[model samples]
Target chain A: MQHKMLYVLTISFFKSFYRNRVAFFFLLIFPLIFVGVFGIAFQFSDPLNSPIDIGIINNDEGVSNGVVILDPFQGKIVSAIRFSDRFISIIGNATYPNNTTKLFNVQEYNSSNLELAKSDLENRRILALVVIPNDFSIGFLAALRNIFADDPLLQNITKNWEGYPEPTFSTKIFIQGDQTLQQFSIASTALRQITEEFFSLGSSKVKGVTISTESELTTQGLTVFDYIFPGLVIFGILQTLSAITTLAMTDVESGLLRRIKITQASGSTYVASMILSQLILSLLQLPIMFLTGVMFGFPLSSRLWYGFVIAVILMFGITGIGFILAGIAKNSEAAIGLANIISVPMAFLAGSFFIVPNPELKWTAKLLGGNTIRVLDFLPATPAVRLMRTILLGQQSIKNSWFDLTLLSTLSGIYLIAGLMTYSKRHFQSQ
Target chain B: MHKIYSNGIHAVKGLSLEVEQGEVFGLLGPNGAGKTTTMNMMIGLLKPTKGKITIFGKSIMNNGKEIKQKIGVAPQEFSFYSHLTVYENAKLFATLYDVKNCERRIDELFNLFELDEIRHQRSDQLSGGQKRRLNLTLALLHDPDLLILDEPAAGMDPQSRAVLWSSVKSLVRSENKTIVLATHLMEVADKLSDRIVIIDHGKDLVIDAPEELKRKFGHGETIQIHVKGDLASDEFSLIKAKVKEIWPDVKNSNHSLQIHTDDAIDDLSKLLELLKQHDLKQKIADISLRSETLEDVFIKLTGRKLRE
Candidate 1:
């Protein structure tokens, strides 16, 4: 009988809300506008396609000795410039690249003029400038002596230079541009990787310590859209809780809440119907955002159901928050004011707008054995956003998200119980 | 029950009364006389600071659900959802009451209250009198054993007021339903209530039948004469001396003279004859004689009119 009453009330509230055009604007039109503005701004722009311009000042002076060189098979008079400017040897595509394509737009500066190169870098002509010292080739050959120690044929060529003082080679790489932190980080990292690869190749056959680099096929590169959409979806779900709070406060000010209390309807039934109605509205809200996101080319590596499951769990937590707001507020205006206070800061700090780097507050948040505090991990929206990112980006499966799901579920349960208790006491006992 | 509000203002103080079954008990007071506070306490909308209330042999605090099922309250304010149609509001209440045969019951109420034509209209769009009737109908939807109507005929036209009075009269006569009513309309209380309680400043001043109260505090007969011109003290004393010779009960204020008599039908002609002998009949603009009423009793007890 109680279930039947709750079901009836839920249906009635849905009908009432359906006819409320003002509610329609808040519940549906408002979020759609948010999605539209973001979609148009980000649809064609992928953050991974950041432009990187690097200048290489290759000043390596090579040796020209009249020594007979041996080809592998015919032993012909094939001469090779043994140690050349290897920094200039690296190549890159002029445009954005796929996995097999070069990673940068590399430019070679012939003159070692520091002032001219600095001017080009300052004028944004290059993201970074790399300078190879003049003794680069001599140092490169000396490092290879250990690798070729067993070969006598190679020993005679380098016998004249046996005690040659080893030159300390300095490869000064300057990162200069009006670039953001993320842009500067990406450019500097790429330049170091390319320079190290060439330096490693100079001592190719060294058997003692082998250094090899591999890029995994399973880890997909994330675009800015990939990083932000999960947070936006979670944000959209949590925002509906404020709308529900406003509706509940409206009921209170209208005296509908008191009138219903005077009836045979129990407080639990009223709260249950309200929560169920909000859940239904949230279910309606998620799809519009998901569809808009997909239209704007938000990548969907995992199936759609994974995002939906996370959304439902997040709705429970958000609805609990709505109940707490409803309990504390006296009217619709108060409810709206209180809801903004709770939601606005959480949205920003919990990574709804932009990622709050874990390192920024690492000492504070990571007080537990180099791990983020458990309470911070379950701060309503943080875990949901992270879990959605991992699942939708195909970085982690559902089985690996047990901790995140448990935290969200526990928060949902605790908040729901606390909200119900507080609301019941405030409304029933006070009245 | 007693009610001292959260602000420490004593709204109702140790006020207690028992309403008999099948009786239309009237609660009367001037504005701010704690009538609303008392009614809210009776219906469990407010918590009293002292004392307790028991309805149907069950405590209201612990047995609210059981008591609420037996009682239906129509608060003085407009409490129905204004966005819904009259029919929708009635249907909602019927559903809340869990009444069987809801549609037929609603149809019956619609016809009985003359609301059949406007049943589909939104409640806010209705005339004030129609809204009042609809409010009363909603309170009666569940056929509660105890119904509380607070100023039910307020903002109503005389015709609508009469219609509601007749319906309430029939409900008590036919169904023997107990009702607790609070109103400032003396005529309403005087005509409908089997017993009336007048409260002032959070205290009950008197509780008895309307006629009994009138007989106790009311002068027998009141004759008011509106004079055209003000009389001097000597002239007023001369008229008072002559009228007091027979009736002996008279007061003069402004240009009006009020005379209390045992029998207006017998003494009215003699009083007018004395004025004519003095050639004062030409100065009398109007003369009216009426039996003492509850309004007079209210003013006699509170030293002010009911609306004051």
Candidate 2:
């Protein structure tokens, strides 16, 4: 009833939270770590459009006697080799395996360590590993004959020529298995260019690229962690508020709150104070998480202030939820458990940990509105995210997202009422 | 008159008791007695679980807040906020009680309890006796007309308890504060209560003045004596027979015999005269004669010790 009491409770809210160092770190640090690890795991860099910095390792020897070996595919070997890259190093050092020979390096050994070598290739560590065979001229010529026509004798001779100088022998023509675009395409084009230099192969021999033209998905490369940073912080604040509310239940049971009840401080005033405390907590939580992102170079979109407005609304909404939970919870443990049950799911579903499902869960979002517990629709948080994102990123407006915004606002109102009702419904019994 | 109608199970069983503007009434009971339940009913916490509780001829259920405001309750349990300083704790309750100038009252209580030095100390941090006293102080801070205290001094040490007893005596005797006290301590009830109500197993065992309960055990005395003169073997027997005619419960020894009687002093005077007539000089080692007290009356009425 009194505005002054609300202000006082709001101040106390931060005092209790900050006094607990473990709680402080758990609320702030835990979510940042959650985001960081997830961000790293979900990272995917687009090379052409984005900075796709890759490390390369080349272990290739130059071609022997200028002969290009057939690529190691059986019947499709000719085409596979035709499409398959023969390196002229696009990325690696220009130093060849044999100074006298101009062709790019190839693997001479058929060892098992090549798996590690291939792993490095996919991660873009090695652009290509080219191990040239000792009898490379002989092996290259015989392989080319077999690719020219599938002659059994030429294949047999090619197999024999692929062997080591004396008694050792194994498979040939190994390229990196898990290749990145840069590592892969560079190797293929380089091989094709080298072949052209040796055989006067037309541009036709160079296979055309299969570039896709679908509606391109160009994100700023926001990872799961980055997206969920604000979310986890919000979740933490809500959970802590709920936990505190539960603790306050003792005040009722122990007669302290009952005594308070007999005072001029009405139930409405008491409930409002608690709500104010929680909202302040959630608000404080927001800035902490936002700072984390900002420090980590995850810019709060320039429209962050609008996002801030949504955050305040969310804080109020969640504070209401916390009060409701606190009112219903029989004890501290129950309060904590119930709060987690609400917050954890909301965090995950609201895309605190990932992208909130899009176009919203159309029918459900319409039916449930913001009041729905189904965070998947992001009823409240979805529009909230959009609002925050647009603000942080300095977007024009939340034009088409009217439904989301409406649902969020409506859900907030509903929760606020429910929370107040829940708080007022329970009476303090004392002797 | 305080009207209390307890319905379900009838722990108090529709009991109605009253006192004048300023009177101390004691509720006496052993452990597991219905004193607490009765108190709860009076406070309107249990909703009677059945009956009606009235103070000043108004139903507590209807005038609960008004009645609650005028009454200060100190529960049997130590119910102060352990986390709060004594001053803060009192201030908190004062605020809750809607008392303006709560700081003055808190200061007053702290000084009254002699807790001014450590008013800032948490209640749980206090010694058991100090906590007991503070608990009383909190209730008194509101200056309520009706003070209902239950097991108030259960955990207090003797000195602190004496201090508390004196304060209570002053509150009732000097300040004319009406107090309804529930206690297991017979001595405390005897010293402070103008009238006592004893309950057992959810029933009122007895309700009367402490002297009345004591008188129920009725005029009886047993005196012990040590002989200085060696009386002949039959000499002691003659005196024993004389004392036994009046006392059905009698015990004897070579030098003494204890007799239960209506008048111990008269019986003692006759025996001493008989000693002189028989030419024997006897030593009167001890003679104690007094009205029966609460301890004897409680044991006699309940057929068990009061402490139990």
Candidate 3:
């Protein structure tokens, strides 16, 4: 009974799904739009300037030390002032700078306008501000004299001096915020590097501390095209097949189907055939995209086979989800609306475009990372970067592979059950 | 077996009806009179809160698939996929019903309904009459033993209605199909149905053959005839006595007359002659007769006019 029913259901789904042009495009074309757009949007490899309009304010007026005791504000500040050109050129360069650019953006400010500048920084108009104190040179000299007094090598001058780099003259460079942990870490490291380079007594004298990040991404030499090819393919097949709210509503709308229902076709068998038809289309999607990506210079060679399985599962799962949602809605309009609602969120949150452990995590990221580690400790995709790094990079394993599978399966299960229940309930209510 | 159930709806109560093999049974009623609900139950689209239905000697509830194999329905309201061609729509339905030969069946239905010329036209583009023809055609395509139709001709033109009726009649003659037709059109029912069940407010009011029920419960009309000239109450009785010489027990009132009889037409002839013999200037001021028709019988039973 099951076998015969399944056979018929499979054929029915195939015939219905392939026959519709809209369903064809939804399955094969729509998802690639996301892939192409998001891929280009996040590419990060353009040699041209990034389109972010960041402002930098440097309020350091050149300071000269009178006492020369601490020698606090003399060297670095003087050096920066003398060569503001170079600092802006490298430091403020978001991309390959024009040949004429200086390292940083310097906005000279009156003491009165300083508060306004701070407000600007808070408003995100300016990325960072550099403030040089008014008695910078003299205060630094006094502090330096104190430091010399404590210095073992200058032990004889101890009674006459204060601390080194006079407190009032010490310069402060403020990046706008410590809002995100990654940014905060970069800022702190850069600051520490600045302090160290200046104090280093060795021959390898560095000009200033700068934060430069390098990313190493390898799709097993399979290239990004290969990775995307499979994802898009899976999306294609999943969307190709179709089912209404209930196996029975189709019967209700057409008297012929109802008659057939009374004839030999079993409901379960009919429904099963329909789902199987969709699965076939979904399965078709991955390979088509996969081959296209490979042909298009995408390096997707690493664990290439897994893409097929994953895509098929996700496709079937999403289709099931669509059915379930349709089942709950009063009509086709509601079903369409609900499917979009869930699909969009899953795409964004589940790393269909980008991998993120918790995209909502920002300044309090450290806390979330810890919590994420605790709550999502079992699933590899808990921290999205970790999962992508593993899958695309061919990392051996994640925290708990079984846990990842279990969580994903649970999610898929929810969509499936919900779809089935909704379909049944709504199908009956359609009268 | 097909069954529909609704709670808090005293729509159907112990309503046991059957259609023998190759018989046409009509369930007749006014609008909102549980006919649709009853048919829905029979189709298993609705689950009855109480009672049981066995079709072909098998339970319809929980065994709908088995019952569906033998039955077809043409619902009161017709809906189909608007985007599809007639052929496409037919084929899709055939597949949903798991027909073995979808293409062949589509051709068959298209030919049967005389829709072959517009087989490729989108269903939404079809005329109301054409769509209805399609509606009827789909029900017949499956070649089932039992068919159910609910208000099948409510909006159809007479020409289209004739087409539908002819096809239904042919189904009975050719396939020996058992049918349950629910309609309020007494004339249509009287013409096509072998037996009829009348219902109101979810309850069965009466069930019999059209002729039998009319004979059993019909209130034959009472005709009052008023002559132009003045006459006393006793004089009218004398007139009746003379009229009874030809037709007896013809009741009358002063300056008026009353008769309780089924044959209003023939009695009126004899009534006119009596006035002639009395040397009365026989000018019939008013003549009213209560004649029993199906409409009168329905009103008598349901307490509301059939058309209402």
Candidate 4:
């Protein structure tokens, strides 16, 4: 008899949910819309391969104090050389190795247009600005002579070098931009490496050191959208919170709960029916969101079964929150409002769209194992998102995500128990 | 049973009544008169503040789950899923009640309530009369021994109300199911109830069969005489003194005089002779008589109309 009640209630809830147009909109359409918009906006571009925009200001005066280099055909070639100009040329012509894509889209600037360049940097048109000092040539020559004086082979070349009287000319190359932006950090690092390369041209002892990267998985050509696809799928699953909350509240306000209370069916039977129905609906959301994501350049993986498991666990937690909301809210309108207030922020805090940095104000606990759990780990979405990204994008096996899976299951159990207790106390017990 | 709300309003105070097996018992009261509250307690939806309630010879407070299975309630509000069809709503309740052969039971209820024609339509799309019928149909789907209907014929036209009343009567006559009918409509109570308890301010004023209540508290009949013109102050006093001799209760208003007596037919000739002797026959325009009703009994007991 209990099983029969559960079956009928589950079917009835499922039918009522889908037949209501507003519930249908929230359950599937709203999250699908989010996927479509974010997919189109990202355009499947790789962030690492994108070029950085930078502005260069050359303010160096040419120095020609009898500096000469021996050419093979022309003997003792001597002329005024502007090292700042040469540095700017090297920056403008720099490109990735074996690729035609330029490293930086360099914008030239003069002393008068320096403010304009600064304004561009402020507006994010250019990620960084390079300001060459006026004594760049003198500083370069002096530094070269000093390096020659230390090496025996290059001491003869700089013994008769007559250029600057000072042993060192104080020169500063300023890289300016907003430090908070990621693009600014990349641009500054590249600029510093280029400066070191230019100074090492005259030294024979300096050796170029390059770091080569290799991927453990076959994720060589992945785009930004690939990393964001799993988050979007989890986002769709979270909307079930609002749908279930409003559905339960509708039952309470319509007095359907009271009607069912008079039946032989137990309170657990009704709650189980609700959870089972929403779990089925939440499972359907995973495939639909995955198919939509695949159409938008998201890479398909063979480990979709892992995602299914995570979706079920996450839904248990979400439905638990829905139960609590329905119990506390006075009516369906307030339930909807409270649902949005909880689910939207939870989605963001769980890093559904982008990665959230660790906050300073967090709590940590030590598990039975040697593992430590952070406050964010208590939220089921956190582990669900992590497991999805690892399994789907990283192409890792289920064994690699055991910790997250366990954490998610534990939190889901806690939420479900809490939800059942609150709902039963509020709606099932005698007033 | 006694019920005092958390806000200190005594919704039901020392209210006690008994319902026999296989009888239509009416609970009559005005608005805010604790009818729903009493029914709620009977079904274990509420716990009495200071009294005990037993259903099927078991304490409702301790054995609520066991007792509720034998009972059914049709609440004042429409309490089924509006998005589902009439048949689906019936099937859902039938399943919850664990009715044997669910499909056949639903079919029988549909036929009984005349809901077969609109069984496939969503409940929200049905008319007010159709919705009320569906509400009662779902409650009766389980074939409960004790069925509680709260204002079953409310918000219906005369034809629809008659159909619902006929269906309820059939349920009692054919199935012998005990019913606790709570309503403010005096006509419904008078026609359907085998016995009724009239309550006001959460206390019972009277409880008896309809005929017994009328014979005990009701004035037998009222005789109204409409006159052509208003009587002079002296003339009105003289007529009042003359009518008071026959029947002690005499009322005058709006160029009309009303006299309450044990029999209007027997008193009609005597009243006319008195008016004729007073030389007031020329002023008499019309005369009519009305028998006593349940509403008259309610007014006599509560000093207010049932709807007030």
Candidate 5:
């Protein structure tokens, strides 16, 4: 009999919510707008497609050995060349494998305008500044002789060389930028690779070492949108807090709550009906948000069910907080206001937008068998968000997220019990 | 039962009354007279500060859940979900009460209240009269034994009020349900209630049948005379002195005078003779006699009008 009543109540609640136009706007349209706007914004600024701007200062004076040499590969006579100029030319003409997009927007700078280049770097006009020293050719020739000395065949080919200075003067090529900037790191790494390849061509004996990266997840390249998609979905789920809070407060202020109190329906049945209705809403929200995210270039995860599990667990906690707000508020307007005050900060603290720094407050919990607990772990959203990112972006299975799932489930249970107790004490108890 | 709020408001003082089964009991009071507070206490919505209230010979405080199941409340405000349609609202309550054959019960209520045509319309869009009818309809959906209606006819037009009163009467007559109605309207209490408790400042001043109380505290009958022309201050004072000789409670305002009397025929003859001797009959526009009503009884007990 109680189960039948719960079912009827849940259906009634759903009908009441969807029939109101304002509720439709908040439940569906509002979150879709967030996805649409953020999706477009992130796609344009994606680092994988956009080129980094860099400035090159080539100051190398050519080392004129006054000797002509035969190129082994081309079988043509060659004259001494400034390696610095060659390196700068290679960097200025570098293009991505797509052949249409350039790897870097290289801006040329002279010795006299070095300060100007540095100023441009500070203002983010350029990500990095490459300064080729005057002794660049000397450094290249000396390094080539050292490599040939290691290989006897290369030493035989360069033994007849004349008018070349001894391999003793070694110089450094400086790459300068703000270390804090991410673009600066990419720019420096690309420049270093180009420099190494240029020298490898000078001496046939020079060999280069390469490192490769592989992921256990999908082979598809992950973008910023993919990484933050779970957070966005979690944000949509958080909006249910306002809706549930407003619904509960409206019942109280309208005296419908008191009216229901006089009915045969137990308080737990009513509360369960409300939670079940909102849980259905949360379940529906996850798929809509996820599909919307996929349309906007978010990577589709095979482990989508993992995200659903996280949403259901997190909603239990959110619904509990909603009831708490309803208990504190005197009316629907105040309930909405309180919901915003709690949910907005909770979204940020849970890293719904960006990764938050771990809190400094840590203590050993004797109750948990001496396990260290951070202040953030107490918030259900913290674990829910982390678990979602792990599943959706990292493409890990549910087995890898047991700790986060357990923490989320425990916190959600605590909140659900707390919410029920507070609502009962506030609304059901006589004055 | 008594109720004192947490904020130290003595909302309901030592007020007590008994509601017999299958009878319409009325709680009549002026504004802020603790009618709602008293009704809330009876339904276990509030805990009385110092009193005991029982329903069906069981303590309401201790057996709240069991007692509450047998009672239905229609609060002063429109308490149901406004977003739901009339039929849906009825169905919701019926289901909550675990009514057998809820569909048939809901249909019966909708038909009884003439709500069949607008059953699909959202409650918030309902007219004031329609909303009041729907409020009463939802209360009767489960066929509760005791129905508590707080200002059920408040803000309704005369036609809608008559429809509600008839329906309420039918519930007691045909359904054998007890009703506890709280209202400040004296006519509603006089017409519908079998017994009424007139309370003021959280205390009951009188408790009896409406006619019995009127006979006990009423001023019998009143004769009103409307003058055609404005009289001089001296003429008015002379008429007042002449009327006051027989009935000292005569009241006059705006060229009109009212005289309270137990013997209307005798007083009417004396009043006419006094007017004729003074040659004031030519100035008399109209004269009428009316019996004292529950409003008069309430005023006699509280020294204030029911609305005040």
Candidate 6:
């Protein structure tokens, strides 16, 4: 009868909970919306699955040797400069050789209008923009000619020239885009390096040991969506806890708890029913969150089953928190308010919504080990988020996540015990 | 049992009661008169400051679960899951009580409470009378030996109240279940209860069968006469003196007169004769003779109205 009672109440609770429109929105739809918003924002490099778009305003015209030429590409009357077709070829031919996929999806625009490029940048149609000045080719050839010239008079003339220098050209290269966004910064940096290498080709004598770059084939290449997917899952779990807590508080305020107390229903049975119902809810939220993440271009790693287990454990720990809130709050409104007070800030600090950046203070770093621990690490969500992030990103195996698992388990056990103690202490006091 | 708070507030003090099997016992009290406190203690929801409660010869303090299984309590407040339908609420309670036929029990309760038409409606959407019925139905689902209903008919209409009282009476007679009812309505106590306990300030003032109490604390008969005009002091004294001739104690005011005697059958004639001797019959506009009731007994004991 005791166990059957628990099952009966749990089933009833779920039936009642799903009928609630507010619970429906919070537990299911809200996470999907969150996934959609962050998914679109991080579409580029979504695990390096697609080509990135970058804008280049190539205003460069060929440099003239004492002769001026009008170039429509430049849209300005200036020194006729040569175009670096090799540079364009390098960019166009860049590809992920392992996947046989193009690296960049270039969109060309005429120099007659810069607004089109700026609008694309503002609308996020392009990741980064590069603008080359008209005198670029002229300055490059002049510097090369001076470096290899045998005629003393020509060398003297180029050396004495004040308009441009032999070792460096004043053809200004300006790059525009958000430096904070990793995708934009990566493209802009690549463009800058490519431009530097192209100019170095003009001089044969300039030589240095080549430092080749190699991309690491690992889960570290995860996109922002990979990082945020698990956060949303954890946030969804927190919402489940909040919903359960509010319902529990309502039961208390409505005298339902009191009525059940005088009957054959024991406190353990009631608590068991509440926890079981919330656990079931968390399980339901899991696949929905994962499916939404998949639709948002999140990498569906092979270790998703592992993430599912972690999510269920995370739900267990958080539902205990709901019980604590239910015990402390005077009513449902206060329960929700208190839940928000705990979850919102913890979400941000513990990396559910965003990770709190590590402080740069030396003593602070010393106090909290630079990489091992952080101020937010004390929060249970921190380890839970980390565990989920690791499992979802496939960065590490579940076997290696002992610290996170232990911490989350211990926290869950503590909260469940404390919540039961607090709830029973208050629940048994008759009105 | 005694109930003393940490702050030295005594809600119920030295209150003990015994209810016989197959009897409907009414607990009557004014607001804050410790009725709810005593009921809570009896159901093991509260701990008595002193003394203990026993049900079915088992101490509630130690054998709470065993005792609780046999008792069903319908609290004064609306006490059911508002989010669930009436049938769902009944089924939940039935299952918790381990009723063998859960579905049939829910169906029975729904039909008995006249909630069959709206069995699928959420409890919060029900009318006040319907909510009360649902609350009572949930408590009675287990068919426990002892049933404690605290203001069960509260907020109910006349028809619903009548239905609830009749149902309670039939349950006691047919099932031999012991019922402890707490209410403010003296008429309910007068008509429904075999025995009644009137309490005040957490103390039981009196307890006996309803008729026995009426006979012990109540005047056998009361006579009241309404005068047409305000009686002058001399005329009031003359009427009072005439009534005192037969009944030594006469109650007289400026515009009316009252007399409480042991026998209305014998006192009515003497009362009329006294009114004629004073020539107050011409001044008298209305007269009434009434037998004693629960309200009269309550007021006589507490010296205050039941609602006050």
- List DockQ for all candidates: 0.32, 0.14, 0.12, 0.60, 0.59, 0.39
Using TM-score as the yardstick, the better of models 1 and 5 is 5
Model 2 residue runs over 4 Å out of place are: A1-224, A340-342, A355-402, A429-431, B1-12, B77-80, B217-308
Taking all chains together, the TM-score of candidate 4 against the true structure is 0.74
TM of each candidate vs. truth = 0.73, 0.61, 0.59, 0.74, 0.77, 0.70
- Give the DockQ (C-alpha) for candidate 3: 0.12
Question: lDDT at B76 for candidate 3?
Answer: 68
Q: lDDT tens digits, residues B1-308, model 5? A: 78889888898888978899988999999989999999988998888899899998999999987887788888888878898899888888888888899888888888888899999999999999999989888788778899999998889999999998888788788889999999999989989999999999999988999989988998788999987676677877777787787778788988889988889899899999988887878777899998888888988887899887
Model 4 scores a C-alpha lDDT of: 0.79
Tell me chain A's TM-score in each of the predictions.
0.62, 0.51, 0.50, 0.63, 0.63, 0.58
Scored against the native two-chain complex, candidate 5 gets a DockQ of 0.59
Residues A1-431, model 2: lDDT tens digits = 35554454344445545555676666656656655554455434221222222222233332433223354324332311222223223322332233422223333224446576655544445445544333333333333443334457654644643531222212133333212122233344344344333322232322211212111112234433444445554454445544555545655666655445544446676676666665665566666666666665465555456566677777667766766776788776787788777777666565554443333233564565543333344335545654454334332255534555676787778877987787667654432
The model with the greater TM-score, 1 or 4, is 4
Greater DockQ among 1 and 3 belongs to 1
Q: Model 4 in CAPRI terms: which quality? A: medium
Clashes of each: 0, 24, 54, 0, 0, 7
Q: Report the C-alpha lDDT of model 4 over A178-233, residue by residue, as the tens digit.
A: 43234554566567667767655645522222211111243545566776777777
Candidate 5 lDDT by residue in tens digits, A1-431? 59988998898888888888898789888888898788887744444545779988878886766654333334444676776766777787776555566778889988899899988876678878888777777666665655554666555555544544465546667787643233554556566667767666654533322211111234134456666677888888888789999877878888888888888888899989998888777767777887888898876657777788888889999999999888877778988998998888888888888755544243555555544455777888888887887677653457756766888999999998998899989998888
Residue pairs in candidate 6 whose N, alpha carbon or C atoms collide under 3 angstroms? A61-A81, A62-A80, A62-A81, A62-A82, A63-A80, A63-A81, A63-A82
Show model 5 residue runs off by greater than 4 Å.
A48-220, A365-372, A395-397, B227-242, B253-255, B281-285
- Candidate 5 chain A weakest lDDT stretch, 10 residues: A207-216
Q: Candidate 1 residues A1-431, lDDT tens each?
A: 77767886787677677677888777877777787678777666555564666676767664445433332223343344434343455535433445444456777777647777777765557756666556555455444444455678766765643643343333233434322223333555455455555545644542222122111112234456555677778878767877878766766777677667778878898889988988788778888888888877776544467888888987888778887888887767888888878877777767676655432244644554443433345567877876776677554567867767777788888888878887787786634
Q: Which of the numbered candidates is closest to the native, going by highest TM-score?
A: 5
Q: After superposition, how far is residue B78 of candidate 5 from its true place, in Å?
A: 2.2
Q: Compared with the true structure, what per-residue lDDT tens digits does model 1 show for residues B13-128?
A: 77989999889999998878898888777778787788888888888888888898888888777777776789988887777777788899888878878899999898879998
